[model samples]
Target: MRLATIHADEGTQAVGVDLSQDEPRFVRLRDEDLGSRPSMIDILSEPDGLHRAESAFNAGRAAGDFVEGRLAAPVPLPGKVLCIGLNYRDHAVETGAEIPSEPVCFVKFSSCVIGPGDPIVLPRVSSKVDFEAELVVVIGKRGKHISKESAFEHVAGYTIGHDVSARDWQKGRPGGQWTLGKNPDSFAPLGPYLVTPDEVGDPHALDVTLSLNGQTMQSGSTKEFIFGIDELIAHVSQLITLEPGDVIFTGTPPGVGDARTPPVYLQGGDHVEISIDDLGTLSNPVVAEPD
Candidate 1:
C-alpha cells in the first residue's frame, strides 16, 4: 500500500492512497482510526499494522471524500532522522575518502524534513549548498539490538529523500559536527508518499537520480549501496532505539555539484527533483535567504 500524510480540509491527516485509482485517491484517516495509534514510529514497527490499516481504510473510504493531489511525506515529523555517509562506494570515491568499516551514521534534526515540492532554504552563512539524492528508509517500529535478519520485517515502507548538504559547512568547520552541515532547516525533503515495503519488489534494485535545473547530477542504483538496507537497520539499531517515522538516509551516489569541474551549486531559482522508481519523486526549489 502506498500511504501518505497530506493537508486535508480537516487539517494534516494520514491517508491510504489507493493506487488502484487512475490517479491515487486519498482516503482520510484519523489518528484513532489507524491500525496502531497514529505514532508513525510504532505503526512501522510491525508489518501487521500495515495489514490492519488497509482493512480499516477500505471500509472507511466509502464515507469520506477523495482528493487528487500528490502524496506528502508519510511521517511529517520524526523524532529523529539517522543518515549514513559513504554507504555508497562511488560516493566515497568521489569525495576521495576512505570506506568505513561499519555504517558511519549522522543525523538531521526533525525540523529538517519537508514534503515534496517544498522550498530548500539557502542560508547566508554558507555559500556552497549541494544536493544528494538518496533512498530513505522509514522505520516502522521501535527496536534496539535487532538482527539484520529480522530488520526487513520492521520496516513500514520506503520513499525518496534529498540529503541536501551545505558543502562549505561540512568540510569547512574543523571538527564542527556534520549536523551543522546537514541539519539546516528543511534540508531533508522526503516523500511524495511512502510506498510500503511489499509494493517495492526489491529495495536493492531500484534506480535513483537527481536532476538540477534540467540536468542530472546523481544517477545510480540502490544496488550500489555498500551496506544495503538490512545492514543499515541492524547497525544503527544497536546504538539507538529507532522509533516509527525515524528515517535512514542511505547515502547518495556520485555526481554531486562538489565533484564538478567547477562546482555548480544551488542558487535562488534552481529547482531539483530526486526520483526513485515506485517510491515517488521529491522536487524542491532552492531559494536565497532574504537579506
Candidate 2:
C-alpha cells in the first residue's frame, strides 16, 4: 500500500492508495468518519489501523481525490528524525574515514523537513551546501531496546529523503558537530510518497540514485550499506524509545559533491531529484534564502 498526506481545507489530509483500478489511485481518509486515526502518526501507531481505514475509505466512495502536486511530507511533524552517517562503505571511503563497527548516528531536527517539490533554502550563511540522497525508515510502533531480529516489525514503511548539508558549518565548527550543518530549515526534503514494507519487498536491494541540474551525481544501491537496517534500528532503539512517525535516514552513498575534485555545491535555481526502487522520485528546487 502507498500512503501520502496532502494539503487540504482544514489542514493536511491523510491519503492512501486504492488498487482497484489499472493504476493505483490515491484516496482521502476521512478521519472524522473513521473516528480513531486522526493523523498519519495515529494511523501508524495502531495495529491493523491501515486495514480498518482502507475498508472505511473504500466504502465511503471517497477515492481518487488526491492531487499529486500538493503533497506534504508524509509525516509532517514527526516526533524526531534520526540520521545515520557514513553507513555506506563507499561513502565512508570517500570521506577518508574508517568504517565504524556500530552505526554513527545523528539527528536532523524536524524543522528541517519539507515535502516533494518544496524549495530547499540555500542559506546565505553557508556557501558549501551539498546533497546526500538516502532511504528513510518510518517507525510504526513504540519500542525500547528492540531486538535486531524483530526490528523490521516496528517499521511503518519507507520513503526517499535528502540530507542537505553545509560542509563549512559541519566540519569547520569549533566543536565539529554536524547539527549546525544539517539543521537549516527545509534541509530535509522527503516524500513523493511513503510506500508500505510489503510493496517495497527487500529494502537491502533497491537502487538509490540522485541527480542535480539534470546530471546524475550519486548512483548506488543499498547493498553497499556498512550497517544494515536491522542492526541500525536495534542499535538506536537501545539508546532511546522508538515511537510512531519517527523517521530514520539510513544513510547516503558515494558521489557527494564535497568529495568532487572541484567541490560542486548547490546554488540558487538548482534542481535535485532522488529516487529509490518502488518509492517515487522526490524532486526539489534550490533557492537562496532571502536577504
Candidate 3:
C-alpha cells in the first residue's frame, strides 16, 4: 500500500494513498487505526505497523472520507538522512572517480528535507547548485550489523529523492565541504508517496530520471548501482544503527549537472522533477533565497 504524510487541520497526518484510480485518492488514517502511532516513524517502528496501516487503508477506502490536504515529507523528520555517493557505476564514470569497493556514505541533516511542491531555495551563498535524482530507501525496523540477506526485511518502502548540491562548496572549497554544500534548506526533496516494497518490486531495476524546467537532464536506471540497497544497509549498519524513519538516498545516476558539458546549475523560477518508476515523481520549484 502507498503511504504518505499530509497537513491536516489537526496537524500533520499519516495517510494511505489509493492509486487504483486515475487520480490518486488520500485516506487519512485515524490515530486508533495505527495503534496510536502518531507519525509515520512511529508506525514503522512497530514490526506489523505497515500491515495494520494497510488494513486501516482498506477500511478507510470503503468508508470514503478521502482527504484533500497538502503533502508533507513522508517522514518529515527522519532521525537520519543518510546518502550514498558514487554508488552508480555510470555516475562514477561521469565524474572520473574510481569505483569504490564499498558504499561511500554521507549525511544530509533532516532540516534539508522538503516535500513535493515545495520550493528548492537556491541559497544566495552558493551559485553552483546541481541536481541529483536518486532512489531513497525508507527503513522500517531498527537493527545494527544487519545482513544483506535480511536487509529487505528492515525496509518499509521506497521514495524518490532529489540530492541538490552546491558544487562550489562541495568540490571548489579548500577541503571539499560536502556537508555544507548539501545540507542547505530544501536541498533534500522527498516524496509524493512512500510505496511499500511489495508494491515496488525489484528496487534495483527501476528507471530513474530527472528533468529541469521540462528538459530531461538525468536519465538512468537503478541497475547501474554499484552498491545496491542491501549492500548499503548492511554496510552502514555495521557501525551506525538503522532506525525506523531513517532514509538512505541510494545515489544518483549519470547526467548530473556537474558532469555536463558546460555545467547547468539551478536558477530561480526553474522547476525540478525527479521520477523513479513505481515510486512516483517528486516535483519542486526553484526559488532564490530572499533578500
Candidate 2: regions farther than 4 A off: 18-25, 60-69
How badly does each model clash, as a count of residue pairs? 6, 0, 0
Candidates in order have lDDT scores of 0.82, 0.87, 0.92
Question: What TM-score would candidate 1 get against the native?
Answer: 0.92
Off by over 4 Å in 3: 35-37
RMSD of each: 2.2, 2.1, 1.0
- Model 1 C-alpha lDDT per residue in residues 1-291, reported as the tens digit of each score: 877887765456677777776767887554565643354444555457777667656765776646545445678888778899888888888889898889998889889988877889999899899889989898887789989899986687898888989988998888864879988898989988888877897899899989999888889988888998999999988889988778889989999999888987889999999889888778888899888
Give lDDT tens digits, candidate 2, residues 227-262. 889898999998899999999999999999999999
Best by TM-score: 3
What order do candidates take by TM-score, descending?
A: 3, 2, 1
Candidate 3, residue 145: how far the Cα is off, in Å: 0.5
Per-residue lDDT tens digits of candidate 3, residues 63-97?
89688888889999999999999998999999999
**Considering every candidate listed, which one attains the maximal lDDT?**
3
